[model samples]
Each structure stands twice: as C-alpha cells, then as structure tokens.
Target: MKRLRIISFVLSTIVFSTTLLTTVQAQGDKKSTAILDAMSNKYQKIKSFKAIFTYTPDGGKSLKGDATVKGTKFRLKMAGQEIFNDGKLMATYIKETNEVNLQDFDPSAGGDLDPTRIYSAYKKGFKYAFLQERKEGAQTFDVVELTSTGKNSQVDKVQIQVNKADNSINSWKIFQKNGQKVTYKVEQFQPDVAVADNFFTFNAKQFPGVEVVDLR
Candidate 1:
C-alpha cells in the first residue's frame, strides 16, 4: 500500500497548495479594497477641492494643469483641452480645433479621464491588488495596482499611489493597451475650497470665437 500512500500524499499537497493560493489572493483583494474605500470615504465627505497636477505622457512633454471638483461638478483645464461639467451638462473645448462639444453629463461614459471618475472608477471595471508600500522621505505611500476587468478596456493597467498618513491620492499612472503611459502627480491640494455653482458651467462669452458643437 506504499503506492496508495504516495498517491494520497500528492493529492493532499495539491489541494493544500490550491487552498493556500486562494486564501492569499482573497487577503490581497481585501487589502486593496480597504485602501480604495478609505480614499473614497475621505473624498466623498469633502464639499469642494482644488488640485494642481502635473501630467506626463510616455515619450511626451509634461503638462501642468488644475482641477476643481465640487460635488458632482468639476472643471478641468489642461494644455489643449478644457472640460466643464455642471452635473447635468458637459462641455469639452478643444483649442486646436476651436470647437466645443456639449453632451449630457454621463458618468458611465467611457474613454475620458475626468476628475469625476478618478475615485469612483476603481469601484467598477477593475480588479485591484495591493502591490506594496513605499516610503519616500517622511511620507509613506500605499501602492495599489489595478487591471481592467473588461476585455475591451482602453487602459490595460493603472497604478495608484496613496498617502498612508492622510489617506489622499498622491499620484496615479495609467497604462494604455497601446503601450502609452500617462502619469499624474498631485502637487497641491486644497480641500473645502469655496467654489460657486456656476463655475462648473461653460460660458460662451469666455471662449470668444469658439464654435459650439452640441453632440447631445
């Protein structure tokens, strides 16, 4: 019965290994979700916030921009584009074409990286893993890696670095399937900044001679 014992031992080893792997994966998933929940909880409580960020693209020049988020309303200004969303309406102005595209604000819409989608994006269409914790100077950052759950997702993976002390997102990197990488680093953040309701709406007078293209 030595052969029978050997077979039983091999089967038991395989079962044990599979269980161990599953448990480890579950623990990692729990950790990643906890980190994301902490960040979302903190940001959801904030009334209004403004942040200056540096955006760097792969093999492209870095650009500096500012984002102001107030509830579901947000305004994003970048090098060639300015996006304004006032909960109901969305306006995207492209400087190169001198055209503004207006659409109904749909949070479930894909392909755009608006400020409204930052925190909540991970909650859906993503499988997250707690990569590791990195210590830089006096700050400790919890790095979480996310892979797109959708087969047709434009982005392949995303890495988010969150400050452990303040539970704030310090930076995030987006890796596209085309091998392009975009990184955004938060330089300055001001929470509870006073913002008017009309600040998120686009005004025709502000653009001067820009053409409005309503695609709604």
Candidate 2:
C-alpha cells in the first residue's frame, strides 16, 4: 500500500511538474503569469519528453528516477519499481518481489493524486504570487509560490522554480499540512524524444518468472 501511494504521488507529480504553469490562476502577478505562459508554450510544442529527477521527502533519503511521457502515456522507473501506463491500463512491477500488478488507469479517480485535475488545482484552491528571482552561477530562475486557501487542503504551500534560459522547470517543493515537505528537482530534460507506443506497455516476456496480478 505504501509503495502504491508513493507511485501515485510521484506519477501525479511528474505530470504536474511537466505541465506546471498551464492552468495557473489569474490572481498571480503579471510577471509571474508571463513567465508561466512562456514555460507553458515551450512545453506544449513538444510531442514527447523524457526527464530525470531527484525526489526527496522530509527526513528520508533522496531517490533518483527517470520518466518518459508521450501524450497520456508514461513510463516511470524509480525506487526499484517500474510503472507503465498506456493511457487505459497501468502496470506496476516490483523488482524485489518479481511481481506486477495490472489495473485500469483513470487519471480522474485518485483524489489529490489525480494528474488530470492537478493541472487545474492552482486555479481553484490556491492563490499564487511571484516570489523572487535567484541566480545560480550563470543560470537565473524565477520562483513562484502558491498557498492553499482551504483549511482542509492537504497541501499547505508549493514553490516552483522556472529556468529563465529556456522557460523550463528546474524544481518544485511541496509543503504538506502535516509539516512534511517533498522536493523534486529536474536533473535533465529531453524534449521531442523518439519513442514508440509500445514503450509505455508492460511486456510479460521481458521478465522471466514474474508473477502477474490482474486487478482490472
């Protein structure tokens, strides 16, 4: 269950990170919105993309993961597990157990972890503003902050850093209501990568002696 939860959260994060500024509310400052718009336009032109990221939860060790996304399909490799979602079905393979769980994929089913809704979350429940600009060596980043307005919101705050050079996302930090924080940093991003539809499907022949659990 814990692993499933992690996968759900990470999957949602990957989608949200990739489409970060698309649906931001109009309440944000003009500078922030302008930066976001540029970033959105940059990503929208790409048909497919691949990213390598580092995930670190509060009080936990950092883990490195890579994900490839093509439209609604995605393949994620992280923490000894590989998740494949071909838009309609999802398969989660655990390396330790040599087992794969297959189930129907519904982006709208998981509340809070729903990738489809996460794109519009900021427009509804959060207030956003331009925080500041930070310079790291030769690169400049625009930082934007979003605060949850609802008292019952699971997330308290979110901070995003966008690279000024190419309008790409650099990293994001999520602060939960329970005082826990999760950070995701993009190590590398490749847009317009060549990939086939079969790349997002799970093949049984790839793993010998693997147990398959079909829950769909």
Candidate 3:
C-alpha cells in the first residue's frame, strides 16, 4: 500500500534516527562541495516549524504526510487508508513490541529518546561530500551529501539542504544506494514549545479496537 510505505520510511527512521549519523565526517571544499556557508546569513536558524509532505516515488500521486519539528523532537503523520480516514492517527511501529499501533509515539517515550538526538547525531555521525549550490525561497542553499562508512556504509547518499544565512539545515533527502529515496521538508518552525511530559505516553486501553500488529 502506498500509504503504508510512506509510514514505513517515516516510522522506521524517525527523522534520521539513523540517517544523519555520518554528517560529521566531511566538510565542503570548493569543486564538489555543496555546503553554502555564505548564503546562510538568514533563514537557516529554525527553532520550530511544520511541514506538509508528499513523497514522489518517481512521481506518482505523491504519498502525503505532515511533520512538525521543534527543537530536537518532531511529530510525523502520514496518510494511511485505514488510519488517515480520520486524520487523527499517528503511527507507531514499535520494534520492541513489534506492534504497529495508530498512536502517537512521543519521541521522549520509552527509555527517554532524547528529542535532540537527530539534530546533533550528525555532529559525530559520519563522513560527507559537499555538492553545488541551489536557491530555494529567498535563501541560497548548499547541498551536502553523506557517505556512511564502516557499519553505516549501506546508507548511500544523504543530501542535506543547508541554509546559507545560518548554519542550520533547511531540508534533507536520503537515498539508499539500492534506490529508495526519502525527502523531508521543513515547513514551518519555532524555537521551542511548552510540551507536557505526558504527551509521549498513551494507554492503548483508551482507544478501543485500535489495530495493534507486531512489526518485528
């Protein structure tokens, strides 16, 4: 199912739970570099934002989803035939439980998944090669591609859209060397939010008949 596939990529990785792992290994140097430090003078610093997503698998109808990231944590909702009907479903394909529940799994849930892990992961994740420059919106963006080494070698090319005005990242694309591609767009952003700790914990008993299927 198209919807399920979208959820798979989003849920499996968790906004680079493992994608940007290799972001720290390389820096841009002219020629093939994609890092645009000069253009990041503005619009590169995102405190928080919301994004409406459409996945183009070689360009079909585009799998739809919405993602909102603030600080180090984010919420992603994908359009699923069964779950999207009401548009309230947030997928949780828990590896530990092997259950695919239509429930929002807070990034902080279960053993404290530090929300900022994704952003800072690249600080020490992997190696990279920067590419050319491109303009998006009012900002000039630099594209930095990543190469996963050692155990991460299978990660293929991960392209990051860097803000020229600021060092912050604008968007990123991940493509498996085998050919699976995923694009994440930063729609709207804010610096921080007042989120309750309870947001991540949900008692399945509250939702009667919620589909719970083991994924592992």
Candidate 4:
C-alpha cells in the first residue's frame, strides 16, 4: 500500500500538474511565471492525454508506468496493479491477488494519497523559480525549481524540465526532507486522444472471479 501510494502520487504529479496549471497562482520569478503560463495555456487546450513515464527512487529500482487522463478522471497502470478514478470513486485492483479495493474519491482531501490534490498541495506550499535553459541533443528545456515554503512539508524541493518547443514536461525530480529523491521522466505523451468516459471506471464484469472489497 505504501508503494502504491507513492507511485500514484508521483504519477499524478506528472499528469495532473500539467492539466491543472491554470489554477496555480502566478507567484514566482517573472520568467518562471511566464513559462508556466505558456505551459498552462498549452495543456489547457488538450481535452485528454495519455502519458508513459518511468520513475526511479534514490537507491531503488526503477519502474515504468502509463496513465490516461481526461478532466478529473484517470486510469493508471504500474507495478502489477491498476488504479481507476472516475471523479467519483476510486478502485485499486491488484492483479496478483485478483482483488479490487473501492473507496469514495475526494479531491478536497489534502494529502499525498489523494492524487487530485497534488496541484493544490503544491500551490499551497511551494514557490517556483526559473533555474536555467538546458540543451540536450536538438531539444532545449526550461529548468524550473520549486522550493517548499513550509518547514513541515515533506518535500524539500522539486526540479522540473519543460520542453521549450512543445511546452511539455520532460521530467521532474522530487527531493524529500529525508534526503530521498525520486525522478520521473516522460517517455511518451499523446494529447487529445479520443477515449470514452467509462474508460476511467472499473467494471467488475471485465474481470471474472475477481474479489471486490468495498472500503467506502
């Protein structure tokens, strides 16, 4: 469960942070704010998106995952488990156990377990600054730093690299107070993909003999 929570939170940071950028306040270095605004504008135009990413924790093995998101709905697959959130309920299915845990989804809850609150949490506790422009191959990236303002916050800092040409996130590294760091990089991104709303909902009929546990 702990691993699942961490993966979900990090994935949400990569996915929803881009989609919900407009809600973030323009309180940062002028350059950083401008860049963020541009990125926000670009993602706001996307009705839906699918992203493939890899995340590695400090001194830990790396794992790759994918997520499909539209509005407040998202379906994430990683580490032999799948999580579905339809802006109403959340279902976490474990393939090995063939068990699904269901719970009510609440975006207003401010915590790491709540994927939808990630952006709001960042907005509330972090301040952004423009770092520098980085070049790799033929692509240039805008590097930005987010420092935690609250002493009690678990996050020490975060560094994000945004692709200059497309205004998309290339990667992000989270630094925790315990000296642990996790890096997440986007391997692929597909925007404005056509998907039905039901894709974000888990249907029991799809998995025969699966045990459903209602935790709501």
Give the winner by lDDT.
Answer: 2
- Give one digit per residue, the lDDT tens place, for model 2 in 68-138: 88777889999899999898999999999999999999865654434534444556667778999999999
lDDT of 3 by residue, 99-210 (tens): 4556443433321112235444334434556676889668897777655553533356567777666655677777775687767665544443455433433345655555
lDDT of 2 at 136: 95
Model 1 lDDT-worst window of ten = 13-22
lDDT of 1 at 68: 81
Question: Which of the two candidates, 1 or 4, achieves a greater TM-score against the reference?
Answer: 4
Cα error, candidate 2, residue 3 (Å) = 1.4
Q: Write the per-residue lDDT of candidate 4 for residues 109-157, one digit (tens) a residue.
A: 5343134434334455678899999999999999988888877666788
Model 4 spans > 4 angstroms off: 1-4, 17-25, 110-123
lDDT by residue (tens digit), candidate 1, 57-108: 7788887877787777778777667778788997877787777888897654
Pairs with steric clashes in candidate 4: none
Candidate 2 positional error at 83, Å: 0.6
Candidate order by decreasing TM-score? 2, 4, 1, 3
Q: Count steric clashes of candidate 4.
A: 0
Model 3 scores a TM of: 0.59
lDDT, ranked from best to worst: 2, 4, 1, 3
Candidate 2 stretches with Cα past 4 Å from truth are 15-25, 110-121, 149-153
